[model samples]
Each structure stands twice: as structure tokens, then as C-alpha cells.
Target: MADTFHDTDALVAALSDADLDRPPALVANAHITGVSVARALSAHDVPVIALDRTDSGVAPPSDAVDYAGQVTYPLDDADGFRADVERIAGALAFEPVAFACMDEWVRGFAETEPAGVRLPFSDLAGVERVLDKANLYALCEELGVPYPETYEVGETDADEIVERLAFPFVVKPAHKRKFEEAFGTNVIEVEDRGEFEDVVAEAEEYGATVLAQERVNVAVGADTSLASYVPPESADRDPLAVVGNAAVRYPEFGSSCLVERVEEPAVREHALTVLEETGYHGISESEFVYDADREEYVLLDVNTRPWKWISMPVAAGANLPMAAYADAVAEEEYEAEAATDGPRDGRWVYLPDYVRRCLTDEAFWDVLSEDDWRSLFSGEFEREGELTTGLYRPSDPAPAVRYLTGEFTDREYYCSC
Candidate 1:
């Protein structure tokens, strides 16, 4: 990794000076997923420029990153973010493919449609249409996909909302990126009518549209995500897809700390249907939560980026970042090979979090299955390859060491799922 550039101008100058044969891929948000993106593309012999807004995360020390820089504006600032993208792109001789690793970056990139950069996903309008959860839920309903029963706080009356949904409902933003920026958390669970009303007031104050959604019990079942990619030209073709489930997610309602690749054909089928229906063209993860009561999987948010456990698919022999890159740069439209889940499914564990949980949570082992323990002990998961786990790689050990000893020790460790 190069010395971090504090501003876009210096970063662009450095990028121009290094003028290589091929255009470098730009990875936004140099966190865990960004590091994985750099590794995936660099392994394919593509040059990479990794960018981030904050210096707190693990990507700064990763060997996989060729160029590391800091952007002045936060991802929510569309104008500032767009200006920075243009600055970086204008300096490079060849057109760079821009990859947004987090939701806010996805929103910024999708909305801006930077002049000189090539986006891995669809055009601005198509990308924006799918990113908003409100539109996603409506599309799910049109396609007969199962999602949690939800009422928009702004559109529906407060009394009607409480009457329609059960107690212990969730209050969340229809547009997640903005809400996360405002509140620093994704979803707020409200236990009673007073709490729900208070949350609605809070959301209104921040100019965010909150939704009252029926709470699905994740304690009984797993959180599943259909990580997939659909080519730009061939929307009709079946997506490169893999199903992964969170065996353990800390905070109960928060992000998955440990995910295992599993065979969920139903998840694949549903995700494919959603992708095809939307005419979505790019890498995406369709998240689902198992509703034990309904004995069905309920559709949640659809992330239009490289997700946290993206390396799991790459390690399982389906490299989405490579596929997206090839499609963007190739003369002809790139067709991805058939997606494989490997002989044994892969595991993606955030080692620091997993280790911390073992020390702190006594019931952690009780939740995981015998097969999960066996696979971990036998090293079957590690056999798939280097990018399978987050932060730790024998080939590139510094990031893990820094993360474990520095960020995690200070309790400042944060990864946007």
C-alpha cells in the first residue's frame, strides 16, 4: 500500500504519475469489502486504486491495495463525491471502473454517474430504482415475493400503524444510507406504542421516512443472502448465484459476524426472479430472513454492491469482482462461467468478532451446529482459499494484525456488513 493521500488532488497526481497500461479499478470505502475487492481484481492482474473517507479501518495497511487515498467529502454528499470522482478519473489516461463497497458509496456513485468512470452496475436511473427499499418492497409484492408486512409512517396514520402491526415492531428508513448517516444505526426496534411514536417523531425531525415493520424472529432461524451477479447485456441469462446464511450474527438484529455458504436453491430462484424482473445488471446481494412462523423466507433489502462476505463466493470459485471487471473492460460483453458452490461450502468469519464472542458470550457455541464446528476444526473452509475469511491472510498478514491489535482492542471496529 502507498502512503495515504489526504486529498483528491494529491491522489489524482499520484495516480497519473503511475500511468500503467491498463486503467486501474477504483474501490470506494477501503474497509474489509474494499480490501477484498482489491485482492480479487489485483489477482486478475488489474491495477487498483483504493479510496476511503475515514482512516480508522483495516484497508490502509493491506498489501493488496496499490493506491490508498482519502476523500474529503462523506458519501452522502453527492456533489462533493461526484467532484472527487471526476478529479480522479480526469487524471487517468484510460477509463477506470468504479466499485463502491458500501451502501452510502453505492448511493453516491449511482446518483452522480461520474463522467469519466465506468460503473459496474446499471445506469443511474436503474441503480437508484433498486437501491431504495420502498421501491424494492413494492417490486417484491408485484412479483409475489414474501416480505415483512410494513406501513410507511409518513403515508399511514400513527393509530392505523399501531393497529395493523404487532408490538415490538421495527422502525427503519426506506432509504437506508441516509438514515444510517443520520442515526448511526440501521434499524431501531420499538417495543410499545409510546416508543414507536417517539421514534417516528425522531425520524421526522431528521427528514427520514420511517417504516413500521413486523418483526421477524431471527433467533429461531438464520439470516440468508443470495449473492449474485447479472451481466449488463444478457439480463435474460441466469445470474451467477450463491446462497449464504449467517450462522451467528451478534446484537441479534445486527450484521452477520459469521456467514457460511449453504445450498438454498429456493433463495437462488427467488433472487434470480427479483433480479430479472428489475432488469438489474450488476453484482447484488438479495437479503432474506427465515420466518419460522410462516415457514418461509421473507425478502428484506437488496444491496447493490460487493457485500462484506463477497470473498466467500470468490473463494468458492465464483469471483464476482473479476466478472464485473471483465464485463466493463472487455471489447465484447462478458459472459460469466456457471456459478459453483464448491464441493464443500465456504465460510467467511470475521475472526476478531468471532474470537471476541467466544471469550464473552457463553451461548455462542450452543447456537452453531456440529457441522459448523467440524468444518472449522478440519480446515475445510480454509481449503477454498485466501479471501474466504475477513482481515486475516497468511499471504498478507499486516491488516489482520493491525485490526486485531489496534482497532478491535480500542473497541472502534466497525464494518458496514
Candidate 2:
């Protein structure tokens, strides 16, 4: 095993020099998430090798060190998918650390690859448990964690669903990806039997099985997650370390649009317990819904890959990407103390939210007083730099330029069902 690289400065210097012979290969999926990872690695001077399916002829950043050829696929074919993985994996040497950007891509890679590849994190079963809504809820039950009251309703047993479950429940597809097209919504909160049947009929169009879960009357807000990496051997053990985390603030009462950090101990304890019970390894984020009414936390779901708010915790202090890289390449075990308590005053507002606040309302003014406005706008706010920001600095701005120009508009690569 190679000696672990501990010094962030040395790692950055070696990566940027362009003279160093060995550079870590980053497998990017051409999604914004993947591009974010690629940019972060690049900022650290690490070489990135991006791969994507070219349905629209879109390419990754031109400044990328080495851009591999595209892997195309039909919308329906399943068998041909393995060929794509084999092609991607074949290009790399032994034990190349892979960063999966999309859920299906990660599933495909895990299912098709040999054990020689150091995936090291979540296995096939763990990924399925985390991604499948029904399975995730079941895991929560087994762990004795609080969750939304849920029951699976197959097509044949649709009539019995209402009889078994209460009214005003949410009907979601068993699969997360099919939520938008099949149900026409990520979740449908039905008030009565009539609405439930209507939703089931709509779901039939996408050929999806549904799960009806009782909507916890708690205030609808985004969930908080703890990001951590569990080793292959410690898959059944407690988390090796918590890298970082983010909390999404929901828009209205549905999905999370705004995200921030929360250092609550109760949220962390429940998240760790859920992860350990599921035997999850790799980079996983366990989510918890804080019920302000009950003054307690409920386990929501776990994400097996870097989520949309992956950069949030990076702004906080625990860098999951760097930890993942270190775990993948290093010989020694890496452990860092879990951050349970800290000053919770700082806020990292998302760019979209900030824009919305500026254009739509006086919300910005209320949040930032006259004195606070100068420091916040001046870039003096302590920002936990993103992984991509660390990799792609101002000295070499080509990657940043290409990234911002929409050269990598191939969204399909990272959003597979």
C-alpha cells in the first residue's frame, strides 16, 4: 500500500506542478455533481478523466487534463449498459478510485465491476437499500428509528392499500427516479380515497409500484444529513469519520431549495445508528427530519453518493471528497473526530437563494443589516472551500471558464434511473 498523503499543501503542490508522474484519476459523469468533483480535484492539481454518454454531443470542460471518449446508450436497453462499464473500467489500471456522480451509474459500476477495483464504500446491497424508498423505510424499521408510516402497494393490491393505511398519506413510487414522470410529482399528499386512486392511476402510466406513507404533520422542511465514509471491513462497524454535512431548507412545504449547516447532536446520533445498521460503506449521507413539534428527530433516508449539496459541508470544515480520495488511495486508516458542537452562527447561502432574495423580496435586507451587508458581500464570510474550488484555482482558470460556459450539458449521464 502507498504511504498516505496527510499534507494538503504538498498534495496541492504536486498536483499543480504538472511534472509529477502519478496523478489520481477522477471518473466524472458529466453532471453538475460530477463536474463539481472534477473541478475540486483539478484545483488540488489532480488529473481528472471524465466519461459520459454523448446523446447530445455535449463535452466536459476543455481544460480537463484527459477527457475520455463518450459512452452512448439506448433509452431502453439494459444488457448493453455493462459494455459501457467494462469499457470505462478497462481504460483504467488496477484499483482506480471511482467517484460515481449518479445513482444508476454508481449501481451499474458496482454491479459490473470485479472486486479488484477499490470501490471500498457502499456495496450493491447497501446502494439498493439507500436508494429504494420501500427498502429504506424497512431498514429504518429494523433499526427501531422513527420514520414516516409507510406500506408498499403493488398493482394487484391497490384496493387494499386504503383499507390498510390512513388517509392524507403520501403516495411515492418505490423508486426515487421514477417519481417525476410516473407520479407527476416527487410526492403526492392525498387527502382522501379519491385522491389516492387518482394518484395510483397516474403512477400506472410509468409502470411504477407505489408506497403510501402517512405524512408526519411536522413542519415541512428540508432534511439534515451527516456525510461519512465506512471502510470495507468496518461496513458493519460504526462510521470511520464524519466528513461534513448540510441541511436543506424546503421551499413552501415540499422539497429542499435552500441548504445550510446544523451541529445538532441528536441528528448525528440517529444518522450514525442508521448507517451502521445498514452496513453501508463508501460515501453515504444519512438524512434526518427534525420534528419541531415533537422536539425530536426522525430518520428520513440515506444517500449513497455525493448529493446536490455536496459542497455545503466543504464550506463547513469536514471535506468528504478529500476524505474519500484519501481513503481510496492511502494505506493507513484515516479517522477524524466527529464535530458535534461548534459556533452555528455562520451561514452559506446558495447562489440561487441569494439571487432570489435580492430580486424578489426584502428578505436579504432583513437577514443582513447595514453593517452585515458589507462583510457578507465583500467575500469576507468564512467559506469552507468546495472540493472543486480547491482543485481549480485562479492560477489556471481554463477549467472554471469551461465549467461556467455550459460545455458539459450532458445531464443524462448523471441522472440515470
Candidate 3:
């Protein structure tokens, strides 16, 4: 059968066919973050239609997309967005399989759950807890997990806060996503109380609830991310998860560009413990920075959706997203198997971002401990090997072609972020 087809019935038949161990049908918004989820599904022969919010036309992440609209939260009309989503899915004759790329998108989908659409994430309340930094850190304390020491303030003033904590500390939003957009930074460092007060004042101006915490030096340890799937309680099974050690990332407080699958028992144990405490049965990413001073991995943040590099795990022979997708849409209970000893040497690399950082930011490239400079110089970043490069797939040339035009010839639309 031709991969591209018209008529809703033909598409439905292709999606619903059981003989084809195809990947789950999906509806995800487009971004570099969602690229991994889309690629993972496409590799499985799953029929996926990424929902592009920018409507810039389909990139590789949006390769199979049919609908394009604004998916922003609190800005776009919520009910209208849902209507548009449902209309598009109905026209395509597809039931949304399990996957969400952004937290705001997740909440939007859950709030107005369109007909035939399903998101493989926690309940709305669970999502709130994960999105709220204060709530998550409190949960960590309850679970006896080692989280960064947070300093709460009655006001946005920082004079006393500075005296109480270390001189160079980090202050960020109690609710991260909101603050990230408002401040353009995930975490801000203040050398003195004056800068702290100014940063906090600016944060308050944006109506953000800010929190101050000790900046545990990540000078020695690796910056790691743990992707996990805790199935709904009905499954009564253990959660399946994967850990990646970052080789190169964008900002000290941002997404990874180069990473490799690793087996960190302590990191795994803490993540599972938190999942068990919350009884969370959904997809989550727990970020930890190896604090050399403490000789342990300190929990930094927990993301309750498909992260920026989520596709890498799938490339390394693990399909946590598939487990959630299968469980969400299938009649039978889905038991996710743990990814094994295979692909240990494999690395997930996004060529564009890696090279971008190397040219623009010395601070990030200077901290490349787990990666070889020579390999990155040669565009061969993977320790085992570069498993994948950006969204540059042989079958999908449009995104790469689009990428090149802006990257080289035209700098106006270049995606630096």
C-alpha cells in the first residue's frame, strides 16, 4: 500500500490494521523537542500526524501533519483550539494515540479532551504538581530524596534571602514554564543581594512566583535526564525508565544536544522512588546534575512530558513513548519492558544544535567531559556512534532542506533557539 493515501477510511484501515506491528497513531505539536517522538513512531511504521502550532509548514517532526494552528496556552482561545483539533482528527479519521510534547499542550488537551483523542499523562492534578516547582520539591522532601535546598520568600525582596543562602545562588519561578517564557531564562544567578533583588523584582513584575535555591556546583558530575513511564494503577506493574548522560547541552539550564544512554543505579532508584510516592502513572523526565562536591546526583527538575531529546532513548533500543501509546490506545494492558544492555555505546546527536553551541558558546563546549572533541569536530559525536542526526532522514528531506536554506543562505529565519 502507498504510504500516502486519500480518503478517511483508507487511513483508518491502515491505522487500525493489527497484522502490521505499526507504531501508534498520534497528534503532537511540532518543535525540535517533539522531533524524537515523531521519529520514534515513524521508525515503527506508526502513522503519525504532528500538529504544528507555528504552521510554518511541516518540518521532519511535522512530516505527517495535516493540521496547523496556535497551541499556546492562556493566549489562544482554548475551546476553539480543541474544536480545530477534533475537526482535523475527524477529517483524518484518526484517534489520537499517546504522546504530548509540551506541558501547556498536555494541559490544553486534557482540559478539552477532543473526541477520539487521548494523552498518556497523569491526571490534571498530577500535572499541576509536576509543573509547580515548589510542590515537586516538597514531594522530594517527603520521599527522602536529595533535592536542592530552596529558600522561600514572603516578598520578592532578596536582601535577607542573600544573607541566608550562599552568595552566588539561583532563583527561578516556583512554576517553571510560565517563568521561562517571561524571563527568557530557566534559572538566574545573582552575585550579590543587589542583583538577586533586581532579578527577583523583575520576575515578580511578570507575575511569577519565584523561589531561591543553592546553586549546587555541577562542576564535577554529569548532567543527566531520566525518562520514565509509570503505567496507570490498573496495570499493577513496575515503571519502565531510561537514563541519559549529557555530553553537550545548550545553556546550563536548558535542553541536551548530545547524550548517551547510561545505567546509573542511584539516579534510577531516586526517580523510581519519586514515581512510587506520587503513584504517578504517566511519562516524566527527572533531571539531575552530578554535584561533585556532594558526590551524588541532585534532582533539578521533573518534566511531565516528552522532553527535547526523548527520541534518543528510542534510538537506543528503548521505546518508553510506545509503552504509553500502546497502553493508552490498546484494549490489553501494556507492560513496558526495560531497555537492556544493548545500545550502551550509542549516542543521540542533533548535528545542528551541537555545531551551533560549539561555534557560539564556549562555556557549554568547554564542559564537554563525556564527548570527544575530535569526534564532534568530524560530525561523528556518538561514543558508540551517532545513531541519528537532527531530523535528517533519507525518507524525509523537506525539513533538512528547509533547515539548510535558513542555516546557510538566509539567516533571517534561522532557528537559533
Judged by whole-model lDDT over C-alpha atoms, candidate 2 comes out at 0.54
**lDDT value, residue 187 of candidate 1:** 89
For candidate 1, what's the RMSD?
A: 3.2
Give every collision pair in model 1.
none
* Candidate closest to the true structure, highest lDDT: 1
lDDT of 2 by residue, 1-417 (tens): 011221323323333433333335545455445655554455455556555554221225434334443443323343555554444444444345677766656765666654334564676777776778777778778877778767887733756777767677788777766667664456788999888888877777777778887666564444566766665553234443332333323233423334556566766777677766676667777776666656666766677876655545554545466556656666645443234563223234444343455565543333434544444445434332212222233444443444444445643223421
Give the RMSD in angstroms, all C-alphas superposed, for model 3: 5.2
Stretches of model 2 off by over 4 angstroms after superposition: 1-20, 43-45, 54-59, 62-69, 73-81, 93-95, 114-117, 154-167, 177-181, 202-207, 220-222, 234-258, 330-347, 361-417
Q: Point out the higher-scoring one by TM-score: 1 or 3.
A: 1
Candidate 1 lDDT over residue span 1-417, tens digit each: 655744677888888788577878888888788888888777777788888876666776777777878774445477888888889888888889988888777777877788988888987677767776777788889988888998887689989988998898898898876677677887888999999878777777788878889998654437899888788865344457778888776554456777888888888888888877777889999999898888889888888899888878777667788888878886645444344434246677776666666677776664445665565556554544322677677667767776767653665645644
Candidates' RMSD to native:
3.2, 7.4, 5.2
- lDDT (C-alpha, whole model) for all candidates: 0.76, 0.54, 0.65
In candidate 2, position 275 carries an lDDT of 69
| Stretches of candidate 3 exceeding 4 Å from the true structure | 1-24, 57-74, 92-94, 155-160, 251-254, 332-344, 357-386, 409-417
